[model samples]
Target: MLYFIAPFIGWFVSGIIKFIINYIRFGEEAKKRIGNGGFPSTHTTIMTTTTLLIGLAEGFLSPIFGLAVAVTYIIIIDATGLRMHVGKHAYILNRLERTNKGETTEALRESMGHTKVEILGGLILGTILAFTLNIIFKV
Candidate 1:
């Protein structure tokens, strides 16, 4: 039970901390209705945390390690590429709407995702958190 709970708890705590830090650093700018990528990505946090825990539990040299790395890469790519592209499109749409005398002006939800730097930061933070926890708990 404890083993199962560790990753979840670590993810939750790390996510909250990241959210708070993002809010503080970015102010209201960080608040978004829909999207990802703020400071430390919750997605990265949970995925990395889970991956680390699994690797520790199973074995880092096992096939699962490759799977986890692949999954993490895919997620980071989606967050920075696809999601960021959507956000840019939304911004353009918003601008076009304003040019049309506000008739088509619909506030497309901004912050569809994180910048590349933000995603990189998330990756680093998640990796550190996972490593630290793994070492501390000896899991």
Candidate 2:
């Protein structure tokens, strides 16, 4: 229960703070923050937070912690690698489609993965939440 709550707290905090900051700095450009792939990656936030909470609860050297790390590594890699790759392709295709005028009815999704700064934001948020939850719940 603690692990579940901890990760969610991290996700919420990261999303809210990033949204507000982006809104302030970028104005309407910050609209991207409302969707996927923006200043902070919510997927990374949730995954990292869960991993850290697991590690804190299970002991850093424990098998569970190792498993958590491995799983998180794969997830983060996918978010930054394959997911970003796909998103880039989508952006390209969408731009190309725009040239076709009425040929395409739907727009492709451009936001799918996090930039380095976005990933870092998630990591920081997750770490803070993990520590806070650990202290509060003594997990």
Candidate 3:
């Protein structure tokens, strides 16, 4: 139950935070955050929460806990590395398209990765939520 609940809670909480932050900062453009890329990385939050919950429930030395940690590490690396670079490419493409094509086409998405600060925010949120949920659920 903790496994199922942890990921859901992580996604919901991180998404709400991201939405609110983007709404405040980007006005109507905040809708874009619903999909990906924001102040709090939803992927990181979900993976971190899930991994920590597993560690708490299964013991940190357990095989499943180790697997969870590996999965979480992969997610973090993808968010900060590959996806970040993809987002940069998207930005450059959007710029080129705008310069050459004018407003005829939609812009490529430029927010597809988490910055260091955003990842840190997710880590903090995930950690807090994991401990809180663990205490409440006694798992």
Most TM-score-accurate candidate: 3
When summed lDDT is taken over every stretch of 10 residues in candidate 1, the lowest stretch is 29-38
Please give me the total number of clashing residue pairs in predicted model 2: 0
Of candidate 2, the 10-residue stretch with the lowest lDDT total is 31-40
Candidate 1, residue 74: how far the Cα is off, in Å:
0.7
Local distance difference test, each candidate: 0.72, 0.80, 0.88
Residue-level lDDT tens digits of model 2 in 71-99: 87887788889889989999999988988
lDDT of 1: 0.72
Error of 1 at 7 (Å): 5.7
Off by over 4 Å in 3: 101-103
Q: Can you give the lDDT of residue 47 in candidate 1?
A: 71
Worst 10 residues of 3 by lDDT: 101-110
Ranking by lDDT: 3, 2, 1
Q: Give a tens-digit lDDT track for model 3, residues 4-76.
A: 8889999999999999998999899788657778888999899888888888888999999999889888998
In candidate 1, stretches whose alpha carbon ends up further than 4 angstroms from where it belongs are 1-7, 26-35, 102-106, 135-137
Model 1 lDDT tens row, 1-139: 5457655765676667766776777778645532455666767766777777778778888898779878988988888888889889988888888888635644887577777666666667667777777788887
Clashes of 3: 0
lDDT value, candidate 2, whole model: 0.80
Any residue pairs clashing in model 1, and if so which? Answer: none
Clashing residue pairs, backbone N/CA/C < 3 A, model 3: none
